[model samples]
Structures are given as structure tokens and as C-alpha cells.
Target: MPIQTRLFVRFALGYLLLGLVAGVVMAVDPAWRFLWPTYLHVIVVGWLTQLIFGVAFWLFPRASRDRKRGREGFIWATLVLLNVGLVLRILAEPFDLGRAAGPLLMASALCHLGAAVGFTANIWPRMGSGR
Candidate 1:
């Protein structure tokens, strides 16, 4: 598997573990129920979506003989943006850090959007007929 694929898969697994732990904590302490959004984001965006992205990137048809996958830079950017955005969200979401957190959360949302765009741009051409 490509390094990017491995990185994505590993990160996804880590997020899954983190989400499960968070869920357990919330179950144990009703006070932590406020973190439901954080746990959901970790599980869905960080784990499930990332896993799908990685596997799809790997399983998708190649772009060409010379360039098997699409642009490497885009893939890298997608990985970085996704992981950074998720980390930022994990830090800012449940803390209620007021104004500072608002910007961080916005930035995180942008990063995630960028990741989606990057992934789409990189993978679109590969979705064609493998002539």
C-alpha cells in the first residue's frame, strides 16, 4: 500500500480508538455528555470518512501507466488538512474556550472542506475508463 494510504488508515484507527474511549467516558460521567459532538465527529469524520477515503484512493483505477495514482501533492495535502482539522476540532470543540475556539473551529471546518476538495480533484481523473 502507498504511504499515504497507510497513514490515513492508521489515523482512522487511532480516531476510532479515541472516539470509543470518549464514548465510554461520556457513558460513565453524565457531565461529559456535552462532548457528544466531539465523539461523533471523531468517529464519523476522523474514522469512517477517512477510512473510506484511504481505501477508495487505493482501490480506485489508476490515472495512467506513468502516474498510477493521481497527484501526490494533493493526497499529501488532503491527509495533512484532514488530520490537522480533526486535531484542531478535538482540542477546541468541548473546551468552550469562547472566542478563540470559534476561529479554530472555523479553521478546522475549512481544512476539512479543503481536504474534500483536494481528494476529489486528485481522484476525479482516476475515475475514468482505464484506457
Candidate 2:
């Protein structure tokens, strides 16, 4: 699998583990104060968000097809920053310092966003309406 695909799979597994653990926690201690929110942040921001981004970047039209300058760097940086940010978020949330993870995640999002835009630009020319 491509690195991007690997990243997506890892992110998915991360979320699944978090969910299973959350379920157990809920079952054991339904009165936990931060159950839902904590889980939401991790699963949504840390997991699903990363998962979607990785998949989008991996499968995005022209993502792998284009070998132009800086494309690989952008994609790899996206993978690194996304996972690093997610890890930071996961660590920060439990200690009530989740804000610490915000910047990293934002940077990661920007990288992925740039990659998506680049991919779109690369493929757009090939997608004409037969004009």
C-alpha cells in the first residue's frame, strides 16, 4: 500500500481502538464526566478527520499521477503533520491541554488542503466537457 493508504488505515485503526475503549469506559463508568467530548475530539478530529484527509490525498485525482516539483513533499508532509497533530490532540485532551494540539492539526489541514487543490488543478484540464 502507498504511504497515504497506510496513514489512512492507521488512523482508522486508531479511531476504532479509541471507540472500543470508550465503549468499555462507558459500560464501566457511565458517570464519567468527559466521556463523550473526549471521545468526540479523538475520534472526530484525531481519527476520522485524519482518515478522510489521508484517503482524499491518496485517492484524489492526479495525486499520485503528477510528479511535478514539491508534490511528494506536500503529500508526505501532510501524512506526518496529520498524524503528529492527531497524536498531540490525543495527548492534550486527557490533560485538559487539548488546545496545544490545535496548531499542529491546523498546519496538517493546510498541507492536505494544498495537496487537494494541486490535485484538482492537475486533473481539471483533463476533465473538460468536450468543449
Candidate 3:
């Protein structure tokens, strides 16, 4: 597997653990329920989505003999943006409900959007394209 794939999968596993811990904390103390959204994103976007991306990157058809896995830079950008967005969201969501952290939340959303676009752009060419 590519190093990028490994990084993404590893991060996904870490996020899964983080999400589980967050869920348990919320379960033990309902007061921590404000983190519900954060927990969901961590599990869904951080774990599930990243895992899917990593696997797809590894399994997808090669764009060419010289360039497999599409674009390395885009993959790296996707990984970075996704994690940055998730981290930003986690840190900013529980603070003042975005009254003070509104920009941060917006930036996080943009980062996620960028990640999605980057992943799509990188993978689209490789989809169904023979090796």
C-alpha cells in the first residue's frame, strides 16, 4: 500500500478510537452531549470516509503505467485538509457554540469541502481507466 494510504488508514483508526472515547464520555455524562456532532463527524468523516478513501486509493485502477493512484499531491492535500477540518471542528464546536469560533467553523467546512474536491479530482481519472 502507498504511504499516503497507510497514513490515512492509520489516522482513521486513531479517529475511531477518539470517537469511541468521546461517545463513552458523553454516555457517562450527558452534559458532554454538546460534542455529539463532533463525535459523529469524527466517526463518519474521520474514520469511515478516510478509510474508504485510503482503500479506494489503493484499489482503484491506475491512471497509467508511469503514474498510478492518480495524483500524489492531491491525495496528500485531501488527507491534510480532511484532518485539519476535523480537528478544527472538534476544537471550535464546543466553544461558545460558534459565536466566537464562527470563522473557525467556516474554515473547517471549507477545508472539508476542499478535501472532498481534491479526492474526487484525483480519483475520477483513475476510475474505470485501465492500468
Candidate 4:
């Protein structure tokens, strides 16, 4: 399939995997509270969010190929930022990594946010199906 479609389904499946892994970890080891939260966020925000956004942008209508905003660069950039943020968030401890990783995490979140907004703006106008 197309890059957008791949990203969409790929992320969703990845999120499902992540959720399963997280659930297993939580079940086996009850010491990691952060694990559950981090896992959910990673799946929900990281995988699921990107999956949905990428698919929307991919499937969204465009007047022409030139007008198509679902370019490769946008998709990669969004995916990269989202993964980076999610990885950092999941890797770090709640109390630790505060000194350095916190800012990076924030930056990552911002990047994803910007990409999401851009994705929406790029495709929303193209979609004239309803609103």
C-alpha cells in the first residue's frame, strides 16, 4: 500500500503489540506503575494517534497530485517525531530523566502536535465530502 496507508495500519498494529506487551509486563511485574501509563500513552498517543492521522491524510481527497499534501516528507517527519517522543516518554522514569529527558520529551510532543496540525490543515481543505 501507500506510505500513508502503511503508516496508518502499521502504527495501529504496533500499538496493539505495544498494548499487549505492556499488559503482559504489568501483569507479571507489578512494580512498574509507569509501565502501564507509559504503555497506554505510547499506544494511544504514539501508535494510535499517528496511525489515524497518517491514514486520514493518506485517504483524504486532493484536487490533484500537485495539490496532494500527503507527501512523503510530511509522513516521515510526523512518524519520526512521534516515535521519538514516545520512546523517550516510555524509557524514562517518572522521577528520573527529569533533568534532561523531560525537555526532549516535551519537544517531541510539540513536534507530533505540529505534525498533526499540519496534517489536518493539509488534508481538511481537500476533503469536501462534508465539512
Candidate 5:
């Protein structure tokens, strides 16, 4: 697999571990129920989505001759943005202390949206022209 694919897989595995830990914590103590959303997002977005992205990037058809895997820089940016957004959400959501975390949550959501756009743009052309 490509280095990027490996990195993304590793990230997914790490998130999976974290999600499991969060699950255990929630199971052990009802007071920690507030972390349910965080655990769910970590598993879904961090683990599953990242794994899909990595596998898709590796398995998709090649880019045109002029481009390498359809703009490697954008892929890198997507990776960074996705992680940053997840991290922001994980940190800010729990400590929201009510409404004080509004800006942080918005920023996190925007970053995640940006990552989705970047990933889509990077992969769209690789779908090929019915060739």
C-alpha cells in the first residue's frame, strides 16, 4: 500500500482503540454518558470513514498522466483537516460547559466539511471517463 494509505489505516486503528476505550468508560459509569457522541463520531468518522478513504485512495483507478493520484497535496490537506476537525470536536464537545463551545464546534464542523470537499475533489477525476 502507499504511504498515505498506511498512515490513514493506522489512524483508523488508533481511533478504533480510542472508541473502544470510550465505550468501556461509558459502560462503567453512567456519568460519562455525555461522551457517547464523541465515541460514536470517533468510530464512524475517525475509524470507518478514514479507513474508507484510505482504501479508496489505494484501490481507485489511476489519475491522468499529468497528475499523480489527482493532486497529492489536496489529499494531504484532507487528511490534516479531517483529523483536526475530529480532534477539535473531541476536545471541545465534552468541555462545552454549556454554550461556551459554540464557536469551537462550528469551527470543527467547518473543518470536517472542508475535508470532505477536499477528498471528493481529489478522488472525483480518478473515477475515469468510462474507460
Candidate 6:
């Protein structure tokens, strides 16, 4: 596997562990119930989506020579944005951080959206023409 693929997989595994730990904590302590959203997002977006992205990137057809696997920079950006968004959501949502967290949450959402766009742009060309 490529370096990017390895990184993605590693991230997915790490998130999976974190999500599971968070879930267990929430289950064990009712007071921690507010963290459900954080755990859910950590598992879904951080673990599952990232795992899919890594596997898809590894298994998908190669891009044409003209494109060269879309753009390495964009893929890196996607990785960064996705992680940043997840981290922001995890930090901001679970605490009673008050109004200060609003902008952080919004920025997290934008980061996720940007990551999706970046991943799409990088992967589209690899889908190959019907011919």
C-alpha cells in the first residue's frame, strides 16, 4: 500500500479505538451521555468513512498518465481537513463550552465538506471512462 493509504488506514483504526472507548465510557456513566454525538461521529465519519476512503483509494483503477492519480496535494488536503473536522467536532460538541464553540463547529462542518470535495476531485478521474 502507498503511504497515503497507510496513513488513512492508521487513522481509521485509531478512530475506531477512540470511538469504542468513548462509547464504553458513555455506557458506563450516564453523566457522559452528552458525548454520544461525538462518539457517533467519531465512528461513522472518522473510522468508517476514512476506512472506506483508504480502501477505495487503494483499490480503484489508476488514473490516466495525464492525471497521475488526480493530485497528491488534494488527497493530502482531504486527509488533513477530515481529521481537523473530526477533532473539532469531538472537542466542541461534548463540552458545555458555550457560544465560543459555535464558530468551531461551523468551521468543522466546512472542513468536512471541503474534505469530501477534495476526495471526490481526486478520485473522480480514477473511475475510468466507459470505453
Arranged by TM-score, best first: 1, 3, 6, 5, 4, 2
Across residues 9-118, which tens digit of lDDT does each residue of candidate 2 receive? 78777777987798689778978646676677667755676677666655544522465222555556555655565555456544555556667556545654654554
lDDT of each: 0.94, 0.59, 0.93, 0.69, 0.89, 0.89
TM-score winner among the candidates? 1
lDDT per residue as tens, model 5, 3-116: 889989999999999999999999999899999988999999999999998898888888976775888877888888889999989999987557658888898899989989
| TM-score to native of every candidate shown | 0.96, 0.60, 0.94, 0.77, 0.92, 0.93
- Measured by lDDT, the strongest candidate is 1
Clash pairs for candidate 6: none
lDDT of 1 by residue, 14-120 (tens): 99999999999999999999899999999999999999989988999998899999888999999999999999999999997888999999999999999999999
Comparing 1 and 4 by lDDT, which wins? 1
Error of 3 at 106 (Å): 0.4
Query: Which ranges in model 3 have alpha carbons more than 4 Å from their true place?
Result: 97-100, 129-131
| Poorest 10 consecutive residues by lDDT, candidate 1 | 122-131
Candidate 1 displacement at residue 11 in angstroms: 0.4
TM-score of 4: 0.77
Model 3, 1-131: lDDT tens digits are 99999999999999999999999999999999999999999999999999999999899889889997788899999999999999999999976753759889999999999999999999998876445
Better candidate number, 2 or 6, judged by lDDT: 6
Candidate 1 lDDT for residue 57 = 88
lDDT of 5 at 61: 85
Model 4 stretches astray by more than 4 angstroms:
69-72, 93-95, 129-131
Q: Give, for candidate 5, the lowest lDDT window spanning 10 residues.
A: 95-104
